[model samples]
Target chain A: MIENMTEIAISQLLSETQKMKYEDYRFVTASCVSLGDDGCDVIYHFDKDLEMKHLKLRVGKGEELPSVSKIYFCALLVENEMKELFGINITDIAVDYGGHMLLSDEELESPMAKQQITIVEKKGAK
Target chain B: MSKTVIPFGPQHPVLPEPLHLKLVMQDEIIVDAIPAIGYVHRGLEKLTETKEFTQNTFVVERVCGICSCMHALAYCQGIESLMNIEIPDRAKYLRVLWAELHRIHSHLLWLGLLADAFGFESLFMQVWRNREKVMDIMEETAGSRVIISVNTVGGTRRDISKEMLTKISVIVDEIKEDLKQVEAAFFNDYTVKHRLVGVGVLTKEDAYALGTAGPMARASGIKQDLRMTGYSAYGELDFEPIIEQDGDSYARTVVRLKEVYQSINLIKQCIAKMPEGEIVVPVKGNPNGEVVSRVEQPRGEVLYYLRANGSKTLDRLRIRTPTFANIPALLHMLPGSQLADVPVLILTIDPCISCTER
Candidate 1:
């Protein structure tokens, strides 16, 4: 189980990350999980002397959230990855790949989002 | 002076994998390097959701050819953690034995590539020739050379016998002796130092701020190593994370070399303390809830996030590889270096494009 995971509102994420940076915490990568209905949870991992802290942010489908790349420059690639894979519209990325960070134009868009499967299952239930 | 843009590899002779970088340059010095990857994006993580949680071990193992066992180990560890399963002591030590062997060969393989990057073909061949000894040990113990799928959700699938342990001790000594001979070439050669010493310097501040891992972070002044957290038998083993203050390409080289010996020592310790018992436990039910499993792979730290909703299939499996974490550092190191040293800088990262894309 992941301990010390403190859930923060999406609006408070940027400030919390800035606080982590000021406290000398190194920014680890972030992971995005689709929560059906195009909504998702973005967990930003940070470390200080090998101790990890996880911050979770929720984005409802086409919603936009602030990027931590401004506070922690290392977050650029991972943020870009979440942008492309899960279609989380994290605005103001340090270097935006514009949804092609890890995928090509020919590939399926937001390939990792769980909406398709959820939609199919919901229709079956109905 | 007009600026120039040079494309460096979706296919380059020096690169073992496809990683393209658009070098924004002025004359011979690189002003910026914009990396482009995805030529071989396999979508392995997405594929894992389809397979049963137990079978996903083999799928995750294929994430990186070099750190295959570590990938399986991390996945198994995650599933085990989510299920609240306590693995046996003997199995924990067995996991360490195989994991460190992977480390030995991986660092050795990178050393050979580093030599090849600087036009030292003979040194490259010699180092690889020595590396084959470690590979022989793996093939003997695991019945496979790379990607030995020995880890399971509860514990390990295979165990090493007393005879194999004795053989490993003898072979590890031989590998250490062989490494000493190559060490002279890497450390004493004037040209090797000239290529590495001051080239591709990443300051301690940049390394930490950018979240560099493994040798890259240790090469700088940071003392961050996941082994200190002691996920496997590492807590019982007597070893320390090698530290280098230089934070240059040379320091990175030195750290990896020293770690080669560290891995050998770890293998010997695991053999000496090899507990005799069951290799695997009966793990019942599916993983539920969320957990993050972290392991120190040869290149750096690898993170696995797993969530399951009381079913055989996992709901989510996210992998964050070290090479992915290190790319920002790779971009940070690229600019301001001479064009000729580009190969060394890229090779210094020991880029596993397969792992990054996954």
Candidate 2:
């Protein structure tokens, strides 16, 4: 399990990210864990001199979260992926792929957060 | 001057993977380069949640064929931490041994690609020809060449016999000897220097700010390597993070070239100090916690985020591969670069689309 994780409000996302950037912490990557009916928990991982630090933010379902790409331009890719795959609406990504970065728009929206679709086989032919 | 936009990839002679860049050119100079990815996306992260925790080990290995062992190693290490299971010392040494061998072959593969980017076909053939010896060593020892599934939850699934270890040691020495023959062409040749040196420069400030990892960061004089975190036998190993300060394509090339040598030395050290004991331990329960693991792959640091519940299936698995993190730096370097140097510049980052899009 991870250590040194500090939970913060979603409003503090950009400012906290800016703080890490000011402190010279390398933005490792962010992961969004969908809580289903409970929205999502977004975690931002960072490292300074190989010491790991993490920030966790809890957001409501379908919430348009703020993008940290302004503070750290490198976060654009993950933010866009989160937008496309998790159905999390992130506002102002440095490079927004409009939900088509890692996936095409026609494939499936928020494929990770969506409920499982079971396929029913046609029995007449057999 | 007229502005012309050129699409650089998704198909190119030098590209090893499908990475497209929309290069905005003003005459012969590139003004902006917009990267277009997802061409190889398989939605593997989303797929991980459906599979049981144990089965996901095999799934993660398929993310990228070249660094499959490292992927397994990181996944297993994270699971072991969640379960509080301590792998045997012999298992730890064996992990390091196989990992360094992967590094040797991976760097060699990059070297060949770099040579090919500059149209040095003979050099490319020679480098890959030497690389086959490493593949042979892995096949002989692990019974699989590319995606060697040697790692498991508690420890390793296989063990190397003493005779095989001796053979690996001899083969690696020969690899070191063979690399020297192509060293001059890469390091001192006029065409290579002309194409690589001073092109796509990333200063130390830009590298850190852009959050680049592995060789992209290290080559620009950042002393950040996840190996220094020492998850496995890296703590006991004797090595330093190779750094080059020039912040140019040549500097990046030199950094990886030196790393190939360093990996050879580390492999030799592992062979000499490998302890004999049980390679695995039994596990009793599913991992029921959240964990993040980092491993230094040949390209750079790869981060894994895993969330498991009390059941067999995992809640989520997120992989922030090194190539994904390096794309911003690549875009940053693209501007103010020559149009002809785009492919060579892309190769310098050693982009792996499978790993990035996974």
Candidate 3:
């Protein structure tokens, strides 16, 4: 259930990768996010002409996608930050994860998850 | 030789922001430098998507207070590009005026901070005291001292009157005289040279390979100023990219000092040639495209990328600050310097860890 706005059905991942590379877009980083219903969104950020472009690739909730850290040195940190923040798992990454700078293990219920959270307007709260 | 691990930061006096460094040392000489960031990460990137496009101007401005105006300007430029709005010619020149004022203030602030790191107390106070004039000018004109919230999506929110411009012109002359005194202290003084002369050397090749930006790269002989792209009213004005041959700490200081004069000159020209027009355009509808904008901030080059999906809020916004690109270069330079010179050397890159971790 990809919510992408791409024109075609991007079934061939290798061809898409080749197409992106051929277009001269340097792969900057890929970050993972967990969605409900056994689905996850893997966002790949690329840069060319000083502009950042995001492409979302979805996988099963427990599945893994390919890593681009081999292509860009900056990706390792992005993948780690996403894993720590969104409770998504990344595989085959080279550098140290730096062990989750912000959150602890028990609080990994995903603060960023799109769930029912209170939004009390300050004007009427008191 | 065994490589002993020595921790360099997280609370080092040399760095303005908290950046942890684990250095592998052989006796007093460093062999490798491993950097650990996120010490001050406030998740600014995630927050930008949540904030309204107008409000993000303030949020992003706080990304680095030293380069606040530049941050806001870059964000505005991206939004303007998306909207296909051509700001008035007068607004363009006004943007240059305020932005150059920001550059001057940021560079002087860095010079003061650098002097303090070297224990040159008198020089530090002199530079910062002179910086107050720029702050006063900013507050008087833009309504805020540090995070001057003048930049808007289509143009700027504030407009300078003819009287304000005359006052600003007088202030610029006063600040230029004071900068000359500060420069004399930095260049002619024996102690500053003794400490910073040969410390933290990065050759031109190393700087280029590591993608160092701003004065750090310029000091290493790379004349790649983004101002040459003719963004804002810089294309209409006459100026030159400041460059230096030496890649040492002192050379970086020289480059910044020279840039202060360039910024002052740029502002003077803008004031002289500024025309009368609306400060901003009426921005309508939702911006719906991906646009990239680059601006030369005090530390180096700052890149802002904005992606909108035809909404009031942007879908994604990413900032690649100069400090972020310079960190890798610092990793290469930190090794091989003496232990005591770590603070001085660390400061040479003008590491804004907040900007990096943001």
TM-score of chain B of each: 0.99, 0.98, 0.97
Lowest summed lDDT window (length 10), candidate 3 chain B:
B205-214
Show model 1 residue runs off by greater than 4 Å: A116-126
Fnat for model 3?
Answer: 0.02
Ranking, lDDT, top scorer first: 1, 2, 3
Clashes of each: 0, 0, 1
Give the true-contact fraction for every prediction, in order: 0.87, 0.87, 0.02
Better of 1 and 3 by TM-score: 1
Report clash pairs, candidate 1: none
The better candidate by DockQ, 1 or 2, is 1
The sequence of per-residue lDDT tens digits that candidate 3 reaches over residues B210-301 is 55788998999977788887899999899789888989989999998988889888988998899887888898888887655778888888
User: What is the TM-score (0 to 1) of chain A in model 3?
Assistant: 0.58
Among all windows of 10 consecutive residues in model 2 chain A, the one with the lowest summed lDDT is: A117-126
Per-residue C-alpha lDDT of model 2 across residues B30-110, encoded as one tens digit per residue: 999889998888988888888888888999999998899999998998888888999999999999999988988899999
Of the two candidates 1 and 3, the one with more favorable lDDT, higher being better, is 1
Ranked candidates (DockQ, high to low): 1, 2, 3
Candidate 3: chain B TM-score against the reference chain B: 0.97
Overlapping backbone residue pairs in candidate 2 total 0
